[model samples]
Target: PICLLDTIGKVFEKVIATRLSAAIEAAGGLSPEQYGFRKGKSTLDAISKVVKTAEEACAGSRWRGGSKSYCLVVTLDIRNAFNSADWSRTLEALQRFNIPGYLQRIAPNTSMVGFADDVAIVVVAKHLAAAEELANAAVRAVESWLTVAGLDLAAQKTEAVLISSRKAVETASVQVGGTTIRSQRAIKYLGVLIDTRLSFKEHLEYVQRKASGTAGALSRMLLNTRGPKQATRKLLTSVVTSQILYAAPAWAKAAQVKTYMRGVEATYRLCALRIACSFRTVSDEAALVIAGQVPLRELIRERAEIHTAVPGRHPRGHGGRGAAGRQRPEPQEGTGAGRDSQPSDEAGTSADPKRGHGSVQQMPTRGYVPIEVEEATAPFAVQAGQAAG
Candidate 1:
């Protein structure tokens, strides 16, 4: 096998794509659920969504009638996703959405998500059965829409993941277009490894391997620092670090993953050390200084510093001190995040203790399993912060 890697799409192609995508999006052609390929929405939006949903499902409340909730996330590539846009079906969809005809004419080889050719559907429910039904319904809707749009669902590559306590019962497998979607202990969704346990251990290992692989290739390319000058080292370092920290703030929630990110940066540190011909045992902080790179954890933390970072502002959402911090809809009384009856000193997204949701519950641990509820009425508040926001 042979393959040629080229610079992403050409400049002119991207300009054309940007113009067309903006138009389509403005016309409501793209779904909000598709955080990828959009200008403002990011991988964090998608990840936080699934995470918040899973957290809520695991934290069952009386309002949910005490049913343990679970989450199933399905990701699939639209067959020939890029060029699969059908003229007739597009027009049909446009009409169905009431998009004006003036904006409906798309050039050949144009599509939503431009070069990003995948989509993911997330379903959260109070029980495995509800989750499966919701997932099935969502898949059917997408399948029908794709068929109409001259697209096919790559069911073979479709991945189904169940997120719940280990004590929770196994769920029936999901089927798309008569092909059964295989279950995975951990599946990469929007570039993050998500396991049923939400431990983030699998994601950490995957990123470690990915960063390690990139470092190996770079090492060979640099000829062990016998080639490439400072500029090259800096550029390569940037590229490798970017790979390691792609969505750091999301998966970094796991403490162990946080520690591993630092180790990944160490590989970059070693490469830099060798480039400077310094000893491998040199302090990591010193190597980072020589490489002109920030520690991976600190890099993510610094990025977090840029957003609406005025004094007293929350990590996300639009607000300032004395302002009600922005949040997702608070989980309802019977929902997962609202199970506890005692309120915390700081608002745990609840103030009045009247509802059983008023208290701060113990966070999930390896041995501890809490009940959860799937409440469309209340998605968990406190979304994952946008890594690129």
Candidate 2:
């Protein structure tokens, strides 16, 4: 195979030299017919400098060479790298560093939108350290410039790995997969904009209507005992009851399978908790969707009781003993929870400890059972009011 040496540093040095030579010749260092340059010691010196700089950069990359270390050269193609628009602060920093306005104006334009507009940079570094640093710097620069232009940087993903070499450098090579790989993407939550003009009934209806359709379909599937539910039940039973939960292969060196089963059990517990909470606000139709015909009696006796502390159910008017929609015990008057019980204090009103409330106990009003007209019209009461006036 032929080798292509990417001598960016070399090219940069050569351009600098050629330009300098041209400038000198323009000032009459050599005649125009001599092309203002020649092949000599000076050329060799420039090449040597370029080679040394490139070597230093390569050394920084961290490759194991000389037939000892396995070498991996990774190239990261940044999807939408430039349009990431994270640069306003960076540009400000540059200004503080005295980068001129003209330079800022002439900075590269990133007009592409969506995933298509991302910038990609090809880096040649010897080790992971140098390669990642170079890639990160390039990414940051694109982000900063985009920020100045009032654009948002989209989510980005990266891939990197070392290529495997069989036998020797001159032999055929193939790709390899490692035991683990990690990747990340950006997410932004713009502020919620709720329109208050929608009537409470309208909002409730909107939610109920949305729930009906989804819940109806889900409920049907759960009740279809011969379908997915059967499969799920079998899976759960196997994990909980089978030998696989407690035993491993005869040749196994560790409890890898048992540990995995434990993980599955933990996940089931978490999911049960979520389902219990969701059942509270869900409409009857939606509740049926999730619970299906799985006899609530059996489920409560089985899965729902996993967390004894979490209340399973309560009478419509009865308050319970957990964080779930229960009336908290009223604290004594001067205590922290009761401090805001006063009506005159707005801070007390807004900071009411019952922040996540489904309902609150209303204070009793001054004593007044319904009054009869005959008692209400008593002459003494009328006379007293007139006398005071």
Predicted model with the maximum lDDT: 1
RMSD of each: 11.0, 36.0
Regions of candidate 2 where Cα sits further than 4 Å from its true position = 1-84, 88-149, 152-198, 224-330, 339-389
Q: What is the lDDT of residue 290 in candidate 1?
A: 72
Colliding pairs, model 1: 59-336, 59-372, 60-371, 60-372, 63-334, 64-334, 342-359
**Whole-model lDDT for model 2 versus the true structure?**
0.27
lDDT tens per residue, model 1, 1-389 = 65543656556456665665655556654433444545565565556556765666666554257644566777767666546554554455445545444445543244343335455655655556666765666666556645544567787788878877746446457879898875688888877898988888887767767877877777766664367887676667556666766655556556445565555656667666655556767787887677655455655554344322321222431112212343333456664543233323211221112222221111111100111122233542221111000
For model 2, residues 1-389, the per-residue Cα lDDT tens digits are 65553799458546644654444334433211111033321211221222222222323222354221222212222234344434454344334434445444433332212222312222333333443444344344434434444443334233332222223222111111211222211111011011111112222233234433444444444443344544363333222222211111111122223442343333333223233334334454454345332222223222212212222222121012121243434556555544234322211111112111111111101100000111112221110000000
User: Against the hidden true structure, what lDDT does model 1 obtain?
Assistant: 0.54
Candidate 2, residue 49: CA error in Å?
64
**Model 1: which ten-residue window has the lowest total lDDT?**
362-371
Identify the leading candidate in terms of TM-score. 1
